[model samples]
Target: MITLDARKEKVGDLLRVSFQTQIKFFLSNTKTKAAKSVIYNYIDIFTKDVEIINLMKEYEAQTNKKLAITLPSEEVPSRDAWVNSSIIFDSRT
Candidate 1:
């Protein structure tokens, strides 16, 4: 029998993005059926740099564990900072 144990490494702060999305769908039958329309809006995301960094710092201090940050790989081209940071991708990739 063999037992293996590996320690995790520390990571850096994550880069959060702020975005907005709006969607609308409609369906209608002009001859006999009624019409229906669905609208989904007011979807947005925002994160403050200072606040996020502060939170990350606090978490690291309390947990004493490495923080693994995540970022979108494609967005790297748009965000220069991601160029030097790890892409922290998931299985979806």
Candidate 2:
């Protein structure tokens, strides 16, 4: 189950692309080191994505121009913060 929090328009697009990559990772039977590396990379990308949105908002406010971005909600639910936020993945099934 994926709960996507509302994000800036451009940021949302990038997230969608990243989600596709994540799906690929899920389909593969990779484990441990490689999996952890991919997860870290995804986190890095997501952090940067939010940063870009924030910078754009600041620039728009300073310049008095409309950037046409859908900003995230003020009270973002923790469950929607990431793709696997509330999921439990167990290999010893």
Candidate 3:
């Protein structure tokens, strides 16, 4: 039987690989700017989630490698925008 920590580690690795693959597929196959924008927004939301951030951090620490999702330069949001948006939503609840 697999231990709990080992399972978690495996899941993390899968998550990272799956995310990378999805991004590559979308970038290559997506044809319209509007559709790509929507997809990028969803990706931003997923990557910015607190739980996902923590998981990525833990994975990086374990593997000694960086796992980052890069978007097109034009589609990338500023750091301040991310922080402010999170604060706005966090304050609402």
> Candidate 3 lDDT, tens digit per residue, 1-93?
887455654654565456545544543564334334433454564345444455445445544656546756666553334333452248676
User: Worst ten-residue run, lDDT, model 3?
Assistant: 30-39
Q: Please name the candidate that would achieve the greatest lDDT relative to the true structure.
A: 3
| Tens-digit lDDT track of model 2 for 1-93 | 533344444554666466535534543543333433444444433433554444434444444655443435574433224444222223354
| Worst window of 10 by summed lDDT in candidate 1 | 35-44
RMSD (CA, angstroms), candidate 1: 20.0
- Judged by whole-model lDDT over C-alpha atoms, candidate 1 comes out at 0.28
* TM-score of candidate 3 against the unseen true structure: 0.33
TM-score against native, each model: 0.27, 0.27, 0.33
Candidate-wise lDDT, in order: 0.28, 0.44, 0.48
lDDT score, residue 82, model 1?
A: 28
Q: Any idea what lDDT model 2 has?
A: 0.44
